[model samples]
Target chain A: MSIKLEHLNYIYSQGTAYEKQALRDVCLELRDGEFVGLIGHTGSGKSTLIQHLNGLVRATSGALYVDGKNIYDSSYNMKGLRAKVGLVFQYPEYQLFEVNVLKDVCFGPKNQGLTDEEAEERAKKALAQVGIDENCYEQSPFDLSGGQKRRAAIAGVLAMEPEVLVLDEPTAGLDPRGRLEILGLISRLHRERRITVVLVSHSMEDVAEYVERIIVMNKGSVMLDGTPKEVFAHDKELEQVGLAVPQVTYLMRGLSELGIPVRRDVTTVEEAREEIRRLLKRRETCGQAAEGQ
Target chain B: MLRDITLGQYYPADSVIHKLDPRLKLIGTMVFLVSLFLSHDWIGYLAATVFLAGVIRASRVPFRYMLKGLKAIILILLITVVFNLFVVPGDVIWEFWVLRVTRQGLSQAGFMAVRLIYLIIGSSVMTLTTTPNDLTDGLERVLGPLRMVKVPVHEIAMIMSIALRFIPILLEETDKIMKAQTARGADFESGNLIQKAKSMVPLLVPLFISAFRRANDLALAMEARCYRGGAGRTKMKPLLYEKRDYAGYAVLAVYLAAMIAIRIMR
Candidate 1:
């Protein structure tokens, strides 16, 4: 129900001329049913860190524990660990390879030792959850539209019934509408299932609106970790590491600097709008009292 | 784990061999390979060995790095040596049930092993020193005469260079696809040989689709830029010969002559 990383360090091509320290002492704890957004620029070790959530990539030094069990141990069940942590990679649509969409979705559950009938049932349910119609189930996965193919790929992971779902830029390369659709689908999945969701994204606005907590990474280390409001409050530090606060937060800060006496920590447009309305109402009430006196 | 491949990898350096004209290097490699076959005795092999060593030293690429490329062909090297050791008939030096070792067999095996090792090293020296771009340009120029007979020399060179460029890219893509499937509980390991291959189907299909998609996009991009084959095409870094290239040819000529002399003496 929890994944904890302690002093994780990963080096690419260790002992070779091309050796690179990709992760440097990254420590994090993701508990059950927590919606966390991992934000970092390119090559900030976001992908590498998430791969360790499961047993896909081993850390050069450190302990990775899943549900209080040390997964880095030699005797750990890597297959079971993978099933517990379902990861959807960027442009996951390319991983779809079965003759039909339903079969592709069944690959994960089948690999987990499910019977064909059971796998099919799970796949069907997962597909429906992703909003893919039953009619598209028997069609070739390649024939689906880009968004549908991506959804089918996500279903392939969801069929495993994982306790933790880690998605790496799941909405990348999609149009604005497709982006919203994918994000909404992920938000709904997190709410209904209460699963630990680790969303790795580049879009500040999307991360601020969706996740309950935010973790900012810089050069393979955690730069900031807190709720959206707490993390966005360190706007200057975030910008120094090639990242920016959400657009709404910037607008709110600008209004505060202009002497509007509004909160500067608003992370979403809705919050900014409410703050402005409150400020205007207070001013109007004060003005009426002064005129009557 | 897929990054161990060193074959066809270029080693950048500021050395005479790296700066030599690509055409000269190409011809020099060809001559060296032909000389390896022409040599008939140990004396000839000794001369070839000395020449190869000198060229490798001058290339400035680490010897160990060059030998890494030979790891892929070690099995083939062993098979050839073993075949020569038992198959050649001559005065028997040792014998067993259905296995006999002869002086001629022993000599042949020794010669075969040396020739195979030297052949790989010779080619590796060329590829390691020259960039793929220069190699393709050299190939096109060397085969330019074939265009008179309508052989599409430029197109062939273009295909080769593109293939070389895509090797690393395709390796990266394969790694990503494998990880994606593994994250979904796809067991690539802990399976029998057939079962393991069956698991690769998920990896292969997506790879092929992406490769074709990339190729299609590249073709469209090229055509959009008004690509029209080899007809009157100009080069950005045209091939030019220098004093060092002349010196390289002279060295190649001397080696070939020595190899020919050894052949005639036998």
Candidate 2:
């Protein structure tokens, strides 16, 4: 299902001294089956915007539609909306409480009204999809290693069979290998399930590598929204908002400045590598032609 | 929804009450609470109400915010009112079966409700204006004489300060956990009492675990900073009474004397 936020605004602790506008007229659309990365500085309202997709937070003065249904409407099915848009909160492992990992994963599906057997089936499938071994399924979630617990917690949300998955910093606090594993798992899921995925992250490199589109938030509004190359092209603007282009984008820009004639907007290492190779090949052909001359 | 809780929350403001020594506010709140129980008459209540209103105005905290703290004790308030209204024997003003609303009962209930409300607001005024650290400092000093009797006053103060400090953090944690569980489709709003209570499992388990984790982290952090039971500790901003604090003490004393005079005259 596609998600659309129209002029959405959210004010926390409204009418009080501590009032803060966490989201300000945020207008965006999440098209079906697209992997989108949301990057923002801390307190930039990225979390607030994502939470609106599933009716977790009602906009203070705007509207949200999920698949053409106004979620804020009194008759809206919030539970159904939540089921369709699985949100994996940061450090989701803290939400685990069941005796075993398998049971914990089943919590979401069961809350969705699935029978024990059906919930278990879906839970097992989700665990396997996240690469959790069957042997660890019966162990307590707290006993699992940090990475494994994270995956298991994610499986709990996956068991709900959401058409759209919103993850807030899924790879935060993980080791290098763990980060790669989690990102790879998320990319694989996006590819196989054809689900619209919204990943909120601080790592610009990871976002550039994995997501098809990027949305940058600053002070509670979308500062930039485009393909990774298009977004990263505004490197100075990103930096002004306490964000940066992917590391490879910087290297590509540095290379172009040094007169290497590489594409300045390259966002990934692979793209940079191919760009340099093509430039070298062109140079070689030009050199041979000069020798013939 | 959890954020609606205002108990023990400090409302930051620059006002005479906020700047007064925490010791004075501490003693003042105690005196006010004692005065609340000093008389059951409107004259006494009138004095207390005026005093509380004056203090709240001096603190510059919005009256609505102070009243928010009363929301948590609403059930207790209702229980006390109901019991006082019906159980006290007096001339009957209204009667239905075993439930009789007595003339004296009516006054008693009204006074009890007022006292309960004043008690909450009066105490919250001190907390709302004073920082937890200052309050603990005042408490440690006020209770210092007991130290000679082997009371671990400083340690007790440290614990109180830590607990006060964690109130907001834990409330924030609870809010996060609730949202996380809600995102997972846990229905905390619907269903029968049993089901509603059952839904709390997802929220409470995470909250307790996170709280314990945080406590452990805090302990490690404190230990790393070489904290050794508040021994040989000097205040970063030691408590000092200002001219306004002396004036506050005089006002408290006058309020207390009025309450006592009203009780004795009655």
Candidate 3:
């Protein structure tokens, strides 16, 4: 399903002393089967924007359309809309309240009105999709390690089988290995399931590695929205917003500054290495010609 | 969602009330409350009201904040007023629909409502002025006598202090959990009573489990710090009753005596 937001604004605690404007006229769209990355500094409206897609937060004012229907329409069923767009919030492991993993994973599907058998079947499939072992299905979710609990929580959302999966800071507080594992699972799910994935993260590397498209937000507004290469090219803008480009991109920029012919758009170490090798080959040829002279 | 709750919100300010010894303020608040209950007529009530108004002015807490605090207890104030107005029978002034509006009842209700309002405002002023750490320190100092009676004064104070410290932490945790469940298509709003309660299972389960885990971590950390209850414990900031405390006590004594005199005259 495609999601579109137009001129959306969200103000928290309206009419109170603590009122804050969290989102400001943010407009964006995500096409079906697209792997999109959302990057922003803390308090930059990334969480606020995603919450609108699932109708978890109603727009204080503006239009939100999902699957060609106005999500904010009076006749729209918000619960059903949420089922279509799954959201896995940051630190999802904290939300595991069920005694066993299977029961917990089935919670979302059951809420969607599926029968017990059907929900359990979906839960099993989702667990497998997240790489949770079948034998651990009946184990207490609380007894599991930190990463396992996080995966179980994600599976709970997956069991609902949302067409658009939005994860907000999914790898926060995870070890390096666990973070890569979770990111890999998300990539695989996006590819094999053909579902639209929206990954909200602060880490530039995570987004640079996985997403085809990147949407940058700063201070309650969209700073930039384009393919990863297009957005990351504006390194100065990202840095001004207290966000950094990927380390490899920074490295490439540094190389370019030193008069080495290198692609500034390189986001991965492998890409940077290959570009460096090409530059070295040209240098070697130039040196041999000088020696021949 | 949990972030909207604004209880025990301390507004940090540099004022006389904030600077007063916490123990003095604690004792002074208790004395004020007891005096309010002892008040029988408008004179005693007026004395207490004037004293509270002075404290509020001295503390530099805006009148609007006190009014906001009063607004929270409006329902209870109304209940008390209604109960006192109808239940006490004396000097009937008017009657409508089996409801007798009497002079005594109306005055009694008015006095009771004002008294209760004052009570809430007075105590709220204490909380508003004092930080939780200072409040706990004051409590431990004042309730030290209770130790002889086998009361777990230190433990109770420690619990209160810890709870106050964890309020923001738990609120952030709760917000995260709610968001996690909301992402999973959990609908906490726009549902029937039963459905809404059922939906909370996802949010509550995670909150409780995390709380338990936090408690475990806290216990271990405390143990690592060599915490061993209140036995032989020393305070970093020792309590001292200054000349102002004596002056405060003298003012309270005079106020109490005048209230007693008013009662006797009545």
Off by over 4 Å in 1: A15-17, A287-293, B60-64, B94-96
The lDDT for every candidate, in the order shown, is 0.91, 0.91, 0.86
Interface C-alpha RMSD per candidate, 1 decimal: 1.5, 0.8, 2.2
lDDT digits (tens) for residues A1-293 of candidate 3: 89988999999867554578999998888999999999999999999888888887889999999888998889998888888999988788878888899999998998798999999999999999999998899899988898998999899999999999999899998999999999999999999999999999988999888899999999999999999889988999998989989999988898899987898899877778889899999999999999999
The numbered model that scores best in DockQ is: 2
TM-score for chain A in each prediction:
0.97, 0.97, 0.95
Candidate 3 — which residues are off by over 4 angstroms? A12-20, A58-63, A67-76, A257-259, A276-293, B1-5, B13-16, B41-118, B144-154, B187-200, B228-261
Residue-by-residue lDDT tens digits, candidate 2, B90-147: 9999999989999999999999999999988888898899989898999999988988
List runs of model 2 lying over 4 Å from the truth.
A282-293
What global local distance difference test value does model 3 have? 0.86
Candidate 1 lDDT over B3-99, as tens digits, reads 5556667877889999998899889989998898898689999999999999999988889877887787899989998898999999999999999
Interface RMSD of 2: 0.8
Model 1 chain A, poorest ten-residue lDDT window? A13-22
lDDT of 2 at B163: 92
